[model samples]
Each structure stands twice: as structure tokens, then as C-alpha cells.
Target: MLNFVEYTTQSALRNAGMRSVISFGIALLFFAATLVSFQVTDASAQSACFERTALMKHLSGKFEEAPVAAGLAANGSVLEVFSSPDGVTWTIVLTQPNGATCVMASGESWMGMKKPKKDKVS
Candidate 1:
């Protein structure tokens, strides 16, 4: 009787151990899948069309103030638009966080109008 009980207990423990390991493996697989999905989404999001109308339409009303450099300078992995001194032409560029600059689009006769300031009531 004693030997039978010991054998049964050992078998149960072994089975429980196997179950734990399998559960851990499944959890790890799920975690890896989530990471891969995020990476793919991130890569796709970073991609740009490099077309004029597409870029202009996407970047409309999203322009931010950027500083002028001697030749050309950009920072961050975001789309940016720089215009000529007369504001008649515009150049769209993508600057990566690693300091890489890619000219996405450029056009002549580009004009942007500033929004009218709202009168404040004191």
C-alpha cells in the first residue's frame, strides 16, 4: 500500500510539472506574437508614400515650426514641410530619429494661410 501511494503521488507531481511547463511555453508564444505584431505595425506606420498629392493631403494642417539649418537639417522620425522665404514653394521631407533626411515631395506656388486670431473678450 505504501509503495502504491508513493508511486501515485510521484506521478501526480510529474504530471503537474509538465502542465506548468506547457503553460509557460504557451504564455511565451503569445508574448512573442504580440511583439511581432507591434513591430509590423510600427514598420508600416513609418512608411511614407513619397508622392506629392498624397503627402500634402496627409500632412495638411499638421505642419509644425522647424528651425532652418545652413544646408538642411531635420530631427525626429516625422514628416515636415519647409517653405521658401517667399512662401511660394514648399518642400516636404521626412526626418528619421537617426538624422536621416528624405525629401518626400516639393512643389512650386505653394501657399499657406494662417488662421485668423480669435478676438478675446476680457
Candidate 2:
């Protein structure tokens, strides 16, 4: 049973013709769920969600990723970005109010913004 968000997410991805990317995301989520069941105590591990620590550890270990940025959404959910050292891989995660964490998205070739140089006084 797909929730509204899930249904719409899939529909949007499919409509955008991101079939391969969507397939990869689904596979990653399933794999994460499988690993989480063994690593986390959360009974809801069947839904590709788990404790933040467990899921983060898996992501960090698998992809060598570390948190780079985060912010609170209007709904109170915290969104975080984890990126690999080489900037070749990244994942966006959402932590719900109930403490459940799930991968919202993942991809490769992620680059961060560059800081502007300061002007010298003449």
C-alpha cells in the first residue's frame, strides 16, 4: 500500500523519465531495509526506515559519506545531506518527528558551493 507521498514520488520520477534512477533508488532502499533489520531494533524496518544512527552508519560505511548540511523543514522534520569525501556520492535523509529516519534521495557527482573571495581595501 503506497502512501500519497510515495505514489506521487514514483509518479513524478516516472513522468520525468528517470526510470533508471528511480530503479536504483528503490533497490537502495530495499537493501537498506534489509541491513537495518539486522542492525536496528526498529520493528518498522520493513518500511525502509530505521534509527538515525543505524541507517547513518550503514550509509557512511557503504559510501564513505558524512553529513555536510542540514536544516529543519516547516513540518519540523530534519533534513540532512551526507556526501562522500570525493564528492562522488551523496544522500539526502529525512528524520521524522517520531525519530524514524529514511533516505529521501541519493545520487552521484555532488558538488558543494564555493565561497566567494573577499575584496581587498584599495
Candidate 3:
């Protein structure tokens, strides 16, 4: 009968709608779990070297990849030269993956007296 056919079609549509909602919810949950996992792993990470060029420029020198402690994973390139005020003192800035910057000074470089933090106008 026409009534029976109509009922069956409506039931099918309702089931399809429920399935879509369930699928969407499951997908959202999966995405959330993935983001949480990435955050956890990234927080404890030590290397973040994607902006190598910018970091090198900020250090004011060139860097060549070199070995480091903590096995091969911990090793990175060292910055050979970084220019600061005073001809003598060259600050070597080392970039680490864990978003840590380390500075080392060459003994030949003299720090001289404290200069005001202001820049010299051209």
C-alpha cells in the first residue's frame, strides 16, 4: 500500500541522518585527539630549526652543522661569528631545537665599558 511505502522511505531517511551525525562526531573526536597528541610531543621537543636563516641572521654570523651532546639527535650546527659592539667581543649565539639560545664569547673579544642601550643615529 502507498502508506506502507511512504513509512519505509521516511524511516530510511531518519537512519541516514543519524548515521551522518554519528560519523561527524567521530571525526571531530579523532581530530581533537590528534591535536592533543601533537601538542604534548611538541612541548617536550628540543629542535625547532625551520627558521634557520632568520636565526642565523639574528646571531650575526654563519653556522655550520656540527655534532653535539645527547647523541646525534641533540647535535646541531654552531655559529662561527656574531658581531656586537666593540671590535674585540664576538658573541657566538647557538640555536637549539628546544627554542633555547645560548651565547658564548671569544676570549680575544673585549667587552669594554658598558655602553648605553640606545642605537647610534646615522
Model 1 / residue 61 / CA error / Å: 29
What are the lDDT figures for the candidates, one per model?
A: 0.65, 0.89, 0.57
lDDT of 2 by residue, 3-61 (tens): 99999999998877887778889999999999987777665344567789998899899
Rank all candidate structures by their TM-score, best first, as comma-separated numbers.
Answer: 2, 1, 3
Q: Which parts of model 2 have CA positions greater than 4 angstroms off? A: 1-47, 115-122
lDDT of 1 by residue, 34-119 (tens): 99999999976764444544544544434422323323344436666676565556676776656555666666665766668898
Q: Which candidate number has the best TM-score?
A: 2
- TM-score, every prediction: 0.39, 0.55, 0.37
Q: Candidate 2: which pairs clash?
A: none
Question: Residue-wise lDDT of candidate 3 within 10-50, one digit each (tens)?
Answer: 99999999999999999999999999999999875644343
lDDT of 3 at 48: 36
Number of backbone collisions per candidate, in order?
0, 0, 5
Stretches of candidate 1 above 4 Å error?
A: 47-122
